[model samples]
Target: MDFALSQEQQMMQRLMRDICSDYGLEYWREKDEAKEFPHEIWDDLTEAGFTGLTIPEKYGGEGLGMEEIVAVGLALGRHGGGVSGPNMLTLGPVFGGISLTEHGNEDQKERWLPEIVDGAIVSLGLTEPDAGLDTAGIKTTAEKDGDEYVLNGTKIWTTGAHVSDYIVTLARTSPMEEGSRHQGISLFVVPSDADGITTNKIDKLSMRCLGSCEVVFDDVRVSEANLLGDEDSGFYHVLGTLNTERIIWSAIPLSAGELALDLAVDYAKEREAFERPIGKNQGVQFPLAESKMELETAKLMIYKAASLYDSGEDCSMEANAAKFIAARAGSNACDRAIQVHGGMGFADEYHVERLYRDVRLARVAPVSDELVKSFVSTNVLDLPRSY
Candidate 1:
């Protein structure tokens, strides 16, 4: 039950903090305003080896695990990069690097891992038009055609497709088995520039820098070699990826919330009302204090899940709990910070507005807070399936 970070983990945290300091809040602010990806900051992180924390050393990565990645993400969020900073790692390192190393055979790893370490962006094409979080209900099909598979489908909320060189796509390779919707699903490493693949950016409320998109695949053909994991077993394999994602994702909003609170506290100390600073008022102090405690609690859970995952343990419950609690804690912290700042919180110059928008998206994305509760009710409480 050692809670302290190892020496290497601390160094990685310091490196991420230094990198974010180099970029500064204004860098993220300008990128968010322009709806452009922060290529410079990402390149810096890649050069520093933070981008490949989850990748194996043999593949030109740091050969670390979930615990180290969580630390890096938290540092990114706390040091002023917000969601976009941590998201760069998510696109390639967590999604591409982890997936390939865990499921892909030797040839697949030899081919993709080095490319990911070299800073290739990999977007996830999972959510379809008909299937939101219901991954098993995806309508996209990949029909076997001799030695190739012809893919035809529509994927919505495919984040970073515009900048991604590859998209880890999920498709139905065979008809559903009776009473088992999870069967027949398969994962593929689809090339972003393949013919018949059209990606149109979807304007969103928050985290605009990375961008989410609607991608259409009409008869996009991929070689059999691109298939990830055992055929019809992707549903099972992806479960591990999802758990890893949830665990590490806890840091993004958690970091954003901490940054927002810091801004609010700084403003409260200097902003005087009736000849006294607002920090003296209990009305202002209580909510900020509560947010601090809540965020602290969520941080512990996040690290617990990450450690368990790194140890090859089942962290499904811990991962969901961490994400659920962290999202609520982070979003609530941002809201309170806005209230504490009064009208200035609405202005982007203060940065709380952007933090609020970006952190709030965690409640519904990757997996909704509602679904997280549903998972607890069933898996943790031994209740019947609600959906």
Candidate 2:
């Protein structure tokens, strides 16, 4: 019931903000223009032990909870420069949540968990060219051949694929049943340099600076040791993992909206229009007011869901709602920011354009707003499934 950050959490947020401040908006804009990943900032994060905020301390991580993770992520988004700053820490937990903590064997955890905590990038490759959101429809297959499994398929939107050493991917090991598409899917830890494995970098509308790509698997082979969970049960495992991903993805918008609102507020106070400060105008004031209200609530929703998840509760509905609310608020904030800035918002030099585009992905990536409404309607309201 109490919704407040503890002193320690506040301190953590301050530390994150300080680190992020070192990399200013101009630093991010320069990287964005070149379409390059922030390696130096990433090194600082890794060195600061922020990358593994949720992993166990035994594995050289910070051994924290989802609240701490959210704090760090929010700080990165609001102050750590931009959305790309938080992207560095997203993949490892994304892979670890499903493959290591939930399903990996002791040996697997020892090997992968430490590396992930140490800031070794580990991406999740689930979305395929044909799968879209229908993950069970994946045609990527991994067949058992003695001690090895041969994989052949292409994965689209494989974020961090270009630089990551390993990615836990989903593929089919057994043939699907006559009518059941969800069955027969399995997960594997695939090396980026495995034979016949190649990546095609993608140019996207936004979040392009985050470094996602299309990874093609052409008869890439891996040892049986790479398998995650039981072979046929990978589909279920992926679903559970996705729930966590949805929660984190949802918070991204909250952070973005907060940052956008802050920038807009600053611009409104300083920018003069019609011989008066824009902040004095009702048009600018109302939208900023609305965005501020939305941002606070969105942040609370994100934190509530994150806290619920750390307690091992079913948070699917809350997570979806968080994503939905945060994305809308973030997008709205960016739009208001554009209106507030008048012309400067459109230019990359101002950086509101970047935040605007980045926030759009929260609505589309992982889940659409329409789909989230469908879920809430059916699950929470006892309505029939619309989709």
Best by lDDT: 1
Candidate lDDT values, in order: 0.91, 0.82
Clashing pairs in 2: none
Report the Cα lDDT for candidate 2: 0.82
TM-scores, one per candidate? 0.99, 0.96
Candidate 1, pairs of clashing residues: none
> 308-327, model 2: which lDDT tens digit per residue?
88898988898889888888
* Per-structure clash totals for the candidates: 0, 0
Error of 1 at 378 (Å): 0.9
Error of 2 at 108 (Å): 0.2
